[model samples]
Target: MDQKTNEEMLMFVEKATAGDKEALETVLLSAQDLVFNLSLRMLGTFADAEDAAQDILLKIMTHLSSFQKQSAFSTWVFRIAVNHLKNYKKHMFAQRPLSFEFYGTDIENGKSGEVPDLTQDVEKSLLAEELKLSCTNVMLQCLDAESRCVFVLGTMFKLDSRIAGEILDMTPEAYRQRLSRVRKKMADFLKIYCGEYGGGKCRCEDRVNYAIQSHRLNPKQLDYTEAGEIPLQTMLEVKKAMEETDDFAQNFAFCKPYEAPERTKRFVREFLDSPQLSVIRNAEGRG
Candidate 1:
């Protein structure tokens, strides 16, 4: 199902809110992949994404009683995730923010010296793929948080404008307008700097050595390249829009679904067995 049907969602909320631990676990786990993937794209690294995702999930569970069943549970979860990520201040990219201009300049002038031989453990092509994924993921950091959210929801996630607008508290028209502006801004940047997607000379293979030397990407510990994939259909329930422009789909196609780390489930299990949660449950009359 693209989205949870209303009856199924209400059943989950009722069971979860009434202290059904198994149902609650099911609800939280259902949201984990969507929240983590969004966090990954917004925060620009696996570790930061996982950290932010854990926080967001906690917020969702604690606030479960406040859900009024007015929207799809997935939509409610997404709303919370987006709000948390936009306001999160401790992520690496937030600490050292990037702009398109600065990133483009780095792309043009960043490479130095000889390309290293990274064919020790894995093929050069694998390292190149790692660098390419790293580079594109980092590029989203160039957009401000709000614009990045707009691009991610509108383009990468292919969310319906109406639902996306509701999540961001914007009118559909306004969301679409912002999405259009950011799309052009990003497309222009890619056209000028990305060789694979545009006319620029900067190739992922050409920058692999510099990326590794700068510690931007680690060949020994490739977080994204080593992660498991969740097929597009198994990801968030995005309602495809007919108006979504086709110009940059290929450019951002690297925004595929990556599975959340297995520790998230363990974290949830720990919370369920904690005294802190016991206090919360008793206070909320959920036990």
Candidate 2:
């Protein structure tokens, strides 16, 4: 978001903190996509990301009054999201953690022959694209939670080092160094194993059938490919413009923003109408 949008969001925050339910909805809606995309990248699945995004939205609501305008509202939301996700233990990937070594081995040993055509009625190319998106997204899980957050914010979201530092509670210098290291690690892994961006021969198209058979991806119910609200070309243009300084930009370009779950607005409406929200607003008004 640009400075104008941030300023607009802050105005909504002012009204929201003062018990304007409509403004509260506006604030939540504004932050929902950012929170959800961050959660999805960090947690590695739509179901887990959706659950985490809702919880993070609630935290944003409960802490609405405490938002000090020292930084962009989106940055503050990112902080809350990072804090929540770093501590979040119930996500599936959190329970079964991943490491680059394991991921590299999986890529190296993964089945890679032409299997029976599983595309059925769907176009083969579409299935291949879905698998490619899904596979690359799962690759983020190989990083530890902190590194994953840094990669998502620094590379994927293109957050500036200083602002990212503010969100992560680190000095800009430190954040830059961490981001550099994380990028190199991801780049090295991709160079050795990922064919799309590197020399290694792991083609996403070749693995589509194997992925479907193994239940890693479902051709019928594609997740990542189907959830994008932003047009791929537009997002690619934005990413291309934002990511000029890295070799892995193409590797990271696949991390596009997804549409927030439709039920998010419904949840906000329900919360706004609830008695619990009334008590909270009353307390904030008193405070």
Candidate 3:
């Protein structure tokens, strides 16, 4: 997310803190996509991400008045997001262990059945993109939640260590060490399993059949990517640009950043209309 200027943020914050509906709406709109993507990458599922995004937004709204302007508004928002995700990770782990062992085991066992023939070239291309995303998603689960957050913010989102540290409430040195560990872990795994890193037995083409057979990848009902909505040339252009990055974790860059879903917009609208905000408004007015 781009940093908002101090003056612009202060204007929004003042109005929002004073219970200005439009200013509150604008604040939510500005940060919604960034928060959603952060949740998506942290939680590793759309359903969880959506839930987390809504929760984070409400938290932000509820506490808008308490925002101190010592830091960028984006930084404060991300701090809330990172803290929520860390807590969510704990709750998620208590429910079930998240791991990539199953994916690796499936690949080693060669669970791929007969490959299906999808007639359309577009379907084939989209399926390949989906498989690549699926692979990267699994790879992300290998790291613990905090490490994953650091890696995502640093490598994928291109935030510097100092900024990322502020978001995670760690020292820049600590963030760099964590990111380095994650990078090495991801690099080692990619070299062994990812065909993109060369000399890997597992290929997207090989896994596409397995994904299809397992009902994980449905050509008729593509669910993983928004490739269908995006122009082919545009998608290709984005991929080409990502390929040009001078990074060892190039495969990490291939997975598209999560876009906020329609439901999130509805959630934000409903939140704005709810009686909860009225109480805040009354309180602010009395003050």
Best by TM-score: 1
Off by over 4 Å in 2: 1-4, 231-246, 282-287
TM-score of every prediction relative to native: 0.93, 0.89, 0.82
**Model 1 lDDT tens row, 140-221:** 9998889999988877678888888999999998888898888888778878898877778788877777887778878788
Backbone clash pairs for candidate 2 read none
Query: Candidate 3: lDDT of 143?
Result: 72
C-alpha lDDT (0 to 100) for residue 139 of candidate 2: 88
Candidate 3 ranges with C-alpha deviation above 4 Å = 1-6, 89-96, 114-122, 218-221, 227-247, 280-287
lDDT of 3 at 282: 79
Indicate the worst ten consecutive residues by lDDT in candidate 2. 232-241
What is the per-residue lDDT of model 3 for residues 1-287, given as tens digits with 9 covering 90 to 100?
Answer: 32455467679879988768888887887677778777877776666788899999988987887798887677788889898997785334326555556656766786554556642455666688777776676567667888889877776666667777888889988888888777777777777767855346888766776677775566665446762232222211111111212356654665456557889988888888989879867776676
Over 150-248, each residue of candidate 2 has an lDDT whose tens digit, in order, gives 889877787777788888889878888888889888888878888886778888888877787777877678777677565323222122223234566
Colliding residue pairs in candidate 3: none
lDDT of each: 0.81, 0.79, 0.70
Between candidates 2 and 3, the one scoring higher on TM-score is 2
Residue 5 lDDT in model 2?
A: 66
Rank the models by lDDT, top first.
1, 2, 3
Instruction: Give the Å error, residue 128, model 3.
Output: 2.1
